[model samples]
Target: MTGRQVIVRRARAEDIPGLVASSAGLFAEDGGTRDSSVNVDWPREHGARSFAAALDDPARLVLAVEHDGQVVGHLMGSLTGPTAKRPVTSATLVSIHVRPGHRRARAGDRLVEEFLDWARRQGAEHAEVTAYSANTDAVRFYERSGFAAMTVTLRQPL
Candidate 1:
């Protein structure tokens, strides 16, 4: 709530539309091709339904960052049991977005901090998030927020 007076809070099912719209712009700003087939709106169309079905499920947590009563950012996370690679309760940040006008104003950092707090409250030992290597700005932001480069995902099309 620095430059824009944002308020971070748990996301409700009704906030899906605004969240999806913000995500679309964020993705495009990061150089993602404007392909509706490979965008947030597509997943939202289906994911929102699933999210609604799991609204009361303890494993899922969705948060929205609102500025001046308008949603300008979102963070979606899920809690998972211990695994061989990550041997402790953990929360993974599935997606986070802040509108372009709101970028570089510490809005993203605030949203992430809030998400981490939520994760810790849910008994997570560690919190994780992923960003495309091509999105260097986001990578830097996460790094500044105390995250390190853990793994890299490479792809080759057949």
Candidate 2:
């Protein structure tokens, strides 16, 4: 691994385009594009608006990880809570995506840490994330980041 420096920070409005690019990289992985029932082309106009909205929303966090002034990674997180089963507030790591070349540079860890800090400030008592069960690499990554499997999601192809 190269000793390159990476910066993780809150996403700015202008960062939408870069963030969307990373989002496309994410969707292309793990069949996200194929599995979607809706017709949504990521890194496009709609996605730009969505990222901008996320930046403005107080309840949501969008982070961008930059390497040498270029956005190579992004993460989205939000606070969820007060379900009938769980009364305590929790933070969900909505999604995270890093460019293929930037994995293992502690960028993912930094992203999670920042999100957790945000959740704690929002009075969240627990943290959670969901990953595709079939993606063993993702599962291991989350596990290393201190997440354990809490639910099993099963799907049927009709």
Candidate 3:
């Protein structure tokens, strides 16, 4: 697993399928308690079309981690607003997914690195990502990549 073997690059529309597939299993494992089939349809169900639209937007950044000519991981983020008091620009990391086989091999790190680089290039003063509270591994991954726990989002279904 030499770092040189893996390449990180901006994602194209063609890469969406792979990114969606990579996330399906993780998404199911993390949530989707009511119906198992809900997990498999997450890509399209969660607005893949809108995601494609955003990916093509200049205001957004999407990157993929490729190994041996296959996209094994991907990360996406977008600029928000000067929502904070410090004249900050908010960037939300919409997604980060690595193929199961590529976990723990720095693929995730590379994706996050590219994401942060894109955010900084866009003049973002603050970056934020939401992770499932039950997903400890994801929390650790973000923390290891220099992210901190800012606030908790409590939800209640009506």
Candidate 4:
């Protein structure tokens, strides 16, 4: 459906199933293809508990985007306070996903916009997210959303 209206709002307990589904989709499309070690089944097996606790945490933001009264996307974020070595508060955009059919419709953008707004309000001095270096689409999306490279992590197989 082109030009359809989509709603972005804080996730409620009832949205957990949708959140889990979208997260599973992310794992399958992102980590599943990018890395062989990722457990694609984790969302289906453990997401309900994790997401439920997140819904109750004030330092966490779980957002769901719905179109035609069905969840089409989800975003998960967390706040981090200052530490001895790191004195600045921060927010991490933990995970995000929009159904393939719902992509290019600004659903992901809407989710990120809400997440950044929430992070700012929570006294976060910085916001960050990590996308696999090989995931060009995700990296481009994050760059377009105003994120730039802060660090590069090189890895070697054991």
Candidate 5:
């Protein structure tokens, strides 16, 4: 904890750098460690364009968590509209990460709450997120945030 108030808000154009940094950190610390094929450098190389496009899309939400005036965390979410076969609006919590020092400080809770609020506003009846099955901490966090395990995804190496 930096002893400074943490603020979570929608990301703006100027926060792209911070968003990219946080995303890269997530890939390095989480994906790189848990998955064999994660490209840790992708965020540094292509995040700016992706995040910029996300910022401009109404169906997406990008949030930044700042502590001591520095971006230490971020969350990205998207809404999917009703389809011909599945006529339900759904929201997906695409990704979220907070610096180690910023964890246990309610920053993640704030991000999830804001995203849920936005989804509700958009008439989303359900929300979902996918976490690595081995990451128990994240599974617990999402469970505490009102998410339940709805299905399992398994993979076998070739």
Candidate 6:
């Protein structure tokens, strides 16, 4: 789709539903699965409430990209603690997702651009984001947006 247009802007409480749906898509695409119906209902309610709260947080940034009047993507970035060990003001990209049909339209780039601008204005000196080690698409997106491999994390089922 050439010559397509997308708008990226601050998310409002009304966008919470779409935001949660996009988040579910991100989780699923990242290899997450639902074990029961409660899984969906729980996150749907909890995620919506969280996103709605973040929308009002001055220290956080939540932005959405819309196409043809429908929200197609969302990005959430947050300011992290600056302790002596990590003294610099850091902004961690909590999550970002673009609907399947919305990929390649630069919506993700626009979201990152807006988030970075906000993070900088809020005194963040460093930015970080984590991706599933095997989800190269997300890793590539972050790399293209100027992120480099900074740390390695390992996990195991307990």
**Per-residue lDDT for 28-134 in model 6, tens only?**
66646422222545446588888988988887898988888877889999998678898888998998988878777888888898889988998999899988777
Candidate 2 ranges beyond 4 A from true positions? 1-4, 33-40, 43-45, 83-85
**Could you tell me which residue pairs clash in candidate 1?**
none
lDDT of 4: 0.91
Ranking by lDDT: 5, 4, 2, 6, 3, 1
Q: Write the per-residue lDDT of candidate 2 for residues 1-158, one digit (tens) a residue.
A: 44267788999987778898988778777546446663446456477888888888888999998888899999999887778998988999988998888877888888998998999999999899987777888889889888898889888978
> What's each prediction's TM-score?
0.82, 0.89, 0.83, 0.96, 0.96, 0.88
Candidate 2 lDDT (Cα, 0 to 1): 0.84
Q: Output candidate 6 Cα RMSD.
A: 2.8
lDDT of 1 by residue, 11-81 (tens): 88788777767666666665365233465455446656655654567887777878777888877788998
Could you tell me the lDDT of residue 115 within candidate 1? Answer: 77
Show pairs that collide, candidate 4. none
**Native-vs-model 5 lDDT?**
0.93
lDDT of each: 0.75, 0.84, 0.77, 0.91, 0.93, 0.82
lDDT of 5 at 109: 89
Per-candidate RMSD, Å? 2.9, 2.1, 3.0, 1.1, 1.3, 2.8
Can you rank all candidates by TM-score, best first? 4, 5, 2, 6, 3, 1
lDDT of 5 at 97: 93
Model 4: per-residue Cα lDDT over 42-150, one tens digit each: 9999999989999999999999988888888899999987998899889999999999888867888888889999999999998999999999999999999999999
**Best candidate per lDDT, number?**
5
Q: Estimate the overall C-alpha local distance difference test score of candidate 1.
A: 0.75
Off by over 4 Å in 5: 2-4
Candidate 2 residue 65 Cα shift, in angstroms, is: 0.6
Candidate 3 C-alpha error for residue 5, in Å = 3.0
